[model samples]
Target: MNLENKYYINNSDLKITLEELKDKGIIYIENIQRGFSKYPNLIIEGSEEYVNNAVKQLVAANGIENSYADFYYGRLDEDEKNKVKEALNEREIVIVESLQLSKDDIFVHLNDELLEILLKLTSKEVLFSTFYFTKYPTLVWGNYGRRYPVFFKDEFVMETVKEQIWV
Candidate 1:
């Protein structure tokens, strides 16, 4: 999808987010758009080697089985994909999203360090498919009776009251 003119995030905000993520043991590099387009997509790039190292570090930190990294490149060839898959197979937990990558798409394991880092960067908790709702939700479910008005009318108070009343 063309991300032009879309409000994915501001540069400063993204920097802050990345800083926080790094503090939580995640590393990322910013890929600024070089062309003339006014609205450019901010791409987060990292090498497979770097990601592997991060996964190992995370496994050690969390004291749990290795997990997978949440991010992936949408345009990787077969050789690159296999290399990534091999690395992921050696881990314990895998976090991946279905994207058009190569002929054979494989899953990888991830550790808590990477997961926590991703959560911080995205400002949202993430989890496996089994815990999808608890991790992310497209819609919120709630119970409301007729006594609780779904549609209501309220009076608008535009004037500011300066007097302070003591009870």
Candidate 2:
């Protein structure tokens, strides 16, 4: 079997199910993020008759659409949207807990947890883009001219923001 990176297909040419992929030679199966993604893709890694499997490719999903902001969130199905909402709603930090507040409280820097959330939104392209960090407090967005609202510390952040995601 000289096949490389080909899916574990049966004699009927239909790709084997996830359950079968493991039993018969297939070692890895996952959706890989490609370019400016729009949806899912299944890539099957090298395999043998249960013992000859070679770890050729490490499969991973895009996780969430973030770089293009305002749009990627909408592109996600209901389940992904819910997960994102949950992440944003988590409140384990205060401006004092992880962020430094300005003299008058008008401006606050990014919290570690929030910064992590923003980083994950960006596309994991071959060459990672630095916009995720450069555009401090705004999060990742593809729109060149759209003015993103500044995130304030004393607002109903988790409750109102997550709810407004649809609006």
Candidate 3:
């Protein structure tokens, strides 16, 4: 049985009750961050029977808007590349880390972390972007006018930055 159940929460103010759902047998949980708090979407994928039961329990406790019928399933495939060659080709290493105003301190910490990662990840000298979101300390990827922000969510750290890096 394909287990892909989609659900939406209208008022995202209520903290997500992950433990309760996990106890009911949730195999995986993916948060769809649309850069908006009002229409937050979460994908809970697992056994069809178990996910449905878990959703019922979640709705009972949180009263979150449930759209169980509309679920999206995605597969992630990693692209293997030679980092040294990419660097030799003058591809500016784009290190992105998602950030929030409340956790600006976290930004400072992760920025330092990204710098360390870049130092190890690339052979070329690292340069910081001064134009976009200077406070976050962006890195230029390729050449002139190709400056990439270190705290972006699109290219490199899309998966790790949201929950792991910054927080």
Strongest candidate by lDDT? 1
> 165, model 2: CA deviation in Å?
34
The lDDT of each candidate is: 0.26, 0.25, 0.25
- In candidate 1, how many Å is residue 126 off? 23
Ranking by lDDT: 1, 3, 2
Between candidates 1 and 3, the one scoring higher on lDDT is 1
Query: Can you write out model 1's per-residue Cα lDDT over 16-132, one digit (the tens) per residue?
Result: 222333344322222212211322112212443433243234344333332223343334555754545554422212322223323322222333434443333222212211101
Over 128-162, each residue of candidate 3 has an lDDT whose tens digit, in order, gives: 21111111112222112322212232333333333
Off by over 4 Å in 2: 1-71, 90-116, 120-167
The TM-score of candidate 1 is 0.21
lDDT score at residue 49, model 2, on the 0-100 scale? 19
Error of 1 at 28 (Å): 9.9
- Candidate 1: global Cα-lDDT? 0.26
For model 1, the superposed segments whose C-alpha errors exceed 4 Å read 1-70, 90-94, 97-167
Which sequence of candidate numbers ranks them by TM-score, best first? 1, 2, 3
* Residue pairs of candidate 2 with colliding backbone atoms: none
Best by TM-score: 1
Quote each prediction's TM-score.
0.21, 0.19, 0.17
